[model samples]
Target: MHDSEDLVVVVDGELLTNTETICTGMKAQHASTMKLLRKHLKQLQTFGEVRFEIRLNPQGSDTEYAMLNEQQSALLISLMRNRKEVVSFKVKLIREFFRMRDALGQRDMTLWRQLQVAIAQEVDSAVRASFGSRLMLDRKKDKPILQSEIHRLESEIQPGLLLN
Candidate 1:
């Protein structure tokens, strides 16, 4: 079987599958699938959040589609009886769910590192720009106070670097 990653959509940091895709995968009629979902809506909500998102078609018509996260999808699949294909498909979907989650986690870590590097560069630049000629020692009386202020600013920007 092919990977089902393309069939999954990420919505607001949650991996979701549309009812049309799930119905197609399970070889069930769309109406029947939707009926089953509505019947168990309460129970499914207890399991996890289920949402319906509205989208506009090319014809300017609004269509509401059900979106299910991994937990909700698994729960819905479990409710289906005597569907052998659905059982297998559920297993595959769950694996893909976790793979997507890991990918998202890696992306978050990369973004966090980039942010840290950006902050460090900005702090370094600010320190250099502020300390240029303004910190000259010709003004001996204000030199000590300026130096102490600079030290405090540096410590605030990056902890544990007190000047010797």
Candidate 2:
């Protein structure tokens, strides 16, 4: 693998195979693109770490019905070069989502949780469709975080500390 070439995973693309290699410039540019992709998909909160691999005679039997030809594959890589831009946008969106949830209070909690579940389902489906592999849902099996602690943390943190 050349320094410029790397594995890339996209929400709506093939699994990483051995033959796929993204160039350095392309990688740099795709950072933003990936971020944006994530931002849109994050609405589902179902997105997980995307895996990128390149291989010859790509596994045809895998799920996701991947039909990427060389040209299509190359185009996807080229477009992903600006990943950070997408990420920036996604961060903003996430914050907004949180803000909305918080401001809406308990009234919105049920709806928000439901939305989260739907997003998870979509991501699970997408992953299976792409890789034909069973997707894992990270269940928050642990105990719920206590509300008092939440308030304490929020109050204890000084405004200046946040920037650091």
Candidate 3:
């Protein structure tokens, strides 16, 4: 649930604006907009930038609506009757789309960094486990080898590093 009236959602790496939201933003009736979209479905599909989904309504009824990416959304807006409200809505939608995109990018970057840290930790743990096994197998004979491995691992996992 988004608080912003002009909120645009990101679905499967694409910014999506549904028919209802578009109609509301444009100050147009939902039925009219849906009709227009259906009438022009072929043209929109030819653009290769829009997706349509069949979703179930809250009342358990099937409903079909077009989900448009940024490019397709812009194109659709351009093709619509150019009212002041529609133009203003288009501007807001574009802005929200970019903002959502940038936020998603930042989130992805953060998740990537976390994954790296997790992998490093797993590597460090594996190295320690190997060292422990070697120490148990050769308590005295492999002391030097174990020491060297420990030193290498310690250097690799320096203080404040990801592994540490």
Candidate 4:
């Protein structure tokens, strides 16, 4: 609902990085870096959260950690929360709110399939609105696009691997 900023920390797969490293790196040269990052990120919105995703290597010997600032993290969390994965259906219903369900006639069993279509359209529109704008999209848009790109690659491999 509100706007926020996010700080992401991504470690290389071979490096076996995690939150501890980020905290350590930030605190190493400057002990209060995390505090600063958190403070700045929180100020971007009224309600914000932080998240960490670790992608382990294929050999299962190392792990790569991804740190997201609040805004970026929020967008990702929203996508993940709303994503109906492993589905053949291209359009999925994103009933984020109960009211949305009633509004889409979700209660009407007969309209269930139609509701899905509507939700799909809504999701497409929302994604386009958020991501389609070149002006609005940037490396620092909501999160570092680079980090997400790296994360995408990491997702393809098995966890607990040691990347070379």
Best by lDDT: 1
Q: Return whichever of 2 and 3 wins on lDDT.
A: 3
Across 1-164, the per-residue lDDT of candidate 3 in tens digits comes to 23343557866555677876777788887668778877777787776755677888667988777788777777777778988887888788888888888887787666566556655655555555577866445545544554555454454334235443
Candidate 3 runs further than 4 Å off:
1-6, 46-64, 134-164
TM-score of each: 0.68, 0.18, 0.65, 0.18
Which residue pairs clash in candidate 1?
none
Task: Output the lDDT of residue 37, model 3.
Answer: 79
lDDT (10s digit) by residue, model 4, range 25-81: 222222243344445555423433444455655557554344543343333233322
Better of 1 and 2 by lDDT: 1
* lDDT tens per residue, model 2, 74-150: 34444443476544433333344344435445534554555455555555555555553333222221112233333
In terms of TM-score, how similar is model 3 to the real structure? Answer: 0.65
True-structure lDDT of candidate 4: 0.36
Q: Give the local distance difference test score of model 3.
A: 0.68
* Best-matching candidate per TM-score: 1
Between 1 and 3, whose TM-score is larger? 1
- Alpha-carbon RMSD, candidate 3: 10.0
Off by over 4 Å in 4: 1-19, 23-31, 43-49, 52-66, 69-164
| Candidate 1 lDDT, 49-149, residue by residue in tens | 78887877446887566888878888887887756898877777778888898988787666566556655654555565567665333344454555555
Q: Once model 2 is optimally superposed onto the true structure by TM-score, how far is the C-alpha of residue 6 displaced, in angstroms? A: 36
Report residue 107 deviation for candidate 4 (angstroms): 39
